[model samples]
Target chain A: MVNTRNMVADNYTPESVAEAVRKYDGVRRKQAIGSLVRSLHIDNIDVVASYGEDAAVIQNGRTALLLAADGIWNKLMEVDPYWAGYCAILVNVHDIAAMGGRPVAMVDVLSASDDAIMTEVSRGMHDAAVAFDVPVVGGHLHPDAPYNVIDVSILGVAELENIIYSSKAQPNDAIIAAIDLKGRIHPSAPMNWDSVTMKTSDVLRSQISVMKDLGERHLLTAGKDISNPGVIGTLGMLIESSGVGAVVDLTAIPRPDLDALGITFEQWVRMYPGMGFIMTANRSDVETVCKKFRKTGMAAQVIGTVTSTKKFTLVKGEQETVLFNFCEEGITNI
Target chain B: MVNTRNMVADNYTPESVAEAVRKYDGVRRKQAIGSLVRSLHIDNIDVVASYGEDAAVIQNGRTALLLAADGIWNKLMEVDPYWAGYCAILVNVHDIAAMGGRPVAMVDVLSASDDAIMTEVSRGMHDAAVAFDVPVVGGHLHPDAPYNVIDVSILGVAELENIIYSSKAQPNDAIIAAIDLKGRIHPSAPMNWDSVTMKTSDVLRSQISVMKDLGERHLLTAGKDISNPGVIGTLGMLIESSGVGAVVDLTAIPRPDLDALGITFEQWVRMYPGMGFIMTANRSDVETVCKKFRKTGMAAQVIGTVTSTKKFTLVKGEQETVLFNFCEEGITNI
Candidate 1:
């Protein structure tokens, strides 16, 4: 690994990184999920788990059904309707993949202010669906709504015994971050790292299936797709859900050539990667999990370790800082 | 049966009824679905049926997975956030029920301008989920969006042999309309018939199961829930999807006391029912199907016959008028 400690600008400190991540819009938006979950929560025998995972798990006989929904932010739609539509599918597919399930199909509810935006959004969805090899089966469309929005929901399936969960991390587990780093920042959204768009359909599908393989082999204890919250923020969510804490080595986290990309390490940690995941595995299985991800052209490394202290701490050589203390605050309180 | 011809206002005629339904906002909104389908359509080996069906069917082993999504209109959300949220679940449940599948769970994407709207919407969704016995497993919540919107998607399951489809109607099939008429018009929306709000969970579940029972008994040729397009418009959609036409006898259509409800026959025909369905069955099975629905406390009757003339017509005693000529115009055009 490159000496990222020396390459960091004088202003970039462990404390500054922690403070910047804590106040980010992407991370702050998640604060409302806790209260919303309390209002919508209801008991059902078939529901295996909900709220905290990437996708909710439902028991269907011997097979497990994964269900999830996501909506595109209005700002994304305004800046680039095409990319907005494309990411709607991209994020949903990751939800199921993060659960170690095979995404079977998707349905969408789309409303547009006009036909021009509608056509462009549909084209983006069509292209992404084709690239991922998942069909947009059916949906409702509001052709004349005063606002433009695209919300997509996906259904995926996996064996009941092979599903990964975000709420199963254990103390002493190795925390790993895997990211596809062979791409540039998205032109439309600087916080987005676009990697999947340049890859072939086969390559994209193969990369997604690695999570399923790792789950089947029983390598990872807990995992989640790196979403809008970026690497550290997303990891905070996972550990929060799992009722644990972690100490991350800032220098050990995988990254592209940040200096070459003309971005600081702070911005790099918060970018929503087009293809990435944060996972925890037993120390014995960490090597196997990293190797599986590396075989797919992704950067994978052990970045941290699960702790019982209930504090999310960051370290870089001698410098150290606490990003979040779950006992006091939460990323997604649910 | 009520002799409603004398109760009609002077302006209510076959021509007037047809013209009123043709220009309704609900029906007109559907016209855009045809072209939107063209843009989003992608072929997959596993999709059993889509586009024209209430719920898209996907093949998986010996079972069929039904997936569908619906969004509440902005006007409804603006008027009553609670009813809007409740209807979001109601419509999704009807989508799966119309397909003769058991709805397993649902996911939602909700965006609200403030906390009050979000709380009300979530409460509405919670109540509906409990009443329907389907769990709201997980969803995305946008607590600070500039607008309020709720989009819900459902996942249902059925044995492959018992799955019903909308594209299977045939010439000479008997057309039947079944509606629960034991309620009043909703105060929040005049065009909505509120049959379900007062019913118990057992009664509502029993009513929904009639379609599944009919499917298992192989009693219907094709069926669809009466949605925003109302009775005649929904029938036109089914027939259009099946590549056939139908002649509906307006007088034979079931209705509540129009004079007591203070609604004209034309307005009553276009009102969205809380629980209603229009279906086509073989002539030999018409009596059995109608009896099944009536036993569940719904109004059922043979209202018309499917035809191959490619023209949707309305007949009232001696007077007749063509409503939609499929050769030139279409309701949904799909």
Candidate 2:
């Protein structure tokens, strides 16, 4: 059991935690992004942000157009193509939702080694798309590939003034961890937290729309959808993009019943929860933002304080450990 | 060598030619799309066109937003990741161009087994993106995959009134085949014709712009950028979408000296030329449309005529071959 009050949480050392997170496949896979980003330059004046955000924003008159692409992990596809297909839609929709945008449609490119498995993937994608109310308008399919892969790209639109940016975190803002705790670990993939599959379309739509509502009311200074890197690593990306840091109180981070779930706190932190977001809110708006998230049944708490210093530290009891030294290294390096 | 003015073109029977094209890997690979399309419901009223077109067009106020995705062949990626990378961008850009829209940005999802080859692929994508003037805005990377795969998606914008649709070919429209003949077969992959990599950006831009120009002028009734299905197969898709048929004179189709290239006429028809388009224009506009393409250094010809029958046929001398009986089986089944 995790020691509820101690900062170290258990006998885990700061170095061990840091190494575990750093060496995680989710975090390490991001290392290749920095180089590809440097090579793919943004020359279009309409492009407001790219590479560092969950979705790229393009200026279109008074509206902002959002675009993003995501691919399934090969192992995940092999283990469960149905889940792979569903996540392809889920992740892309969240990319837009993280930007406080209205996801409209998606296009997918699926490469498969066989037909039956591809059908399973397609079925999962279809069910997700309908649940999210976003159309998979069109895409490409490579039927006879040696390996199976599913990639999806999404399009969204948002009011220019209401678009939430990941690079706008301020020094005095409070970092909030908002997660839906009413789900079990995916039976097939322990790393995945399953919450959306069992939820009604109405509930899921309302949950995703809360971000837009927050953006409209200017409740958060910065925000990002929690992805494969989990809450801590995702926060590192946000802070790196914002050029700031945070000292998180470990006990304040939200979680389900870990004992019942049969997962350690470290393992839970690394899971890709079905519905989660990390956000930084102005000190005056932290209570209101947390209240809004709580309205949607999400466990929201002010878990940390943003700082001017470029080091991310986790504090538990009297002991403190630095998770990322942005001045020296970064999760994505971009 | 192919004998000119022969009824059978190369002593090949019409049935054999039809079977060869129908069974081509490029055309057969698209077989999985119809079922996927049926599963993905397009309920959004803004979706103007989806499964059948090169790009999905969504209505956005006075403008149209175009979205499209394409993945490279797996064997090609393994043989040459660099060309695979370039073609990823090339094909996505062409998707927008085929819709008569100006491509604004791109997002890619690249899965690789190693860093060195990924770096090479990234370099190739970067070079092609820079040459095409479309920035790679944002995307995902799967670094440690068992195989290499590159998927790219494009976002484009066009005037709502001027958007050219693939399903608009008139009964008597002339089918125009515009291809750049100044380049040789790709050394890395014989199936691909290398034209864009060797041409200057000015020429490539001009060639791509011709479709938009034709759209604005209302010269083309329908259009599609030639893709993996090759010229004849691609034209079949256009005609099928329009619910019409075409009789193409094989001898009049544009070519790049197949004898010198040491390829048969059938192989030439199946090659995926880098810079080519199949468009349907009014009989009176054919001269102007062909002239416009010629100005961009492309070989343009009116080698076919659209008909009301739901069958795509090929003609050589006095012999005629039914390439596709679309009434019975359409290419994409969309």
Q: Name the candidate that leads on DockQ.
A: 1
List, residue by residue over B206-227, the lDDT tens digit for candidate 2: 9999998888888899999999
By TM-score, how accurate is candidate 2?
0.97
Clashing pairs in 1: none
Task: Provide TM-scores for the models.
Answer: 0.97, 0.97
DockQ of each: 0.86, 0.81
TM-score of chain A of 2: 0.96
Tens digit of per-residue lDDT, candidate 2, span A221-334: 999999999888888889989999998887688988776576767777778988999999988998898888788888999999999999999876677889889899887888
Writing each residue's lDDT as its tens digit, candidate 1 over B1-334 gives 7664566543466888899899988888999988888988889999999899999998989999999999998988998899889999999999999988999999999999999999888888888888889989898887779899999999999988998788899999999999999998988888889898788988899999999999999999999999888998889899989989999999888999888888888888888898999999999999999998999899999999999988999988778899999899777777
Model 2 segments more than 4 A misplaced:
A1-16, B1-16
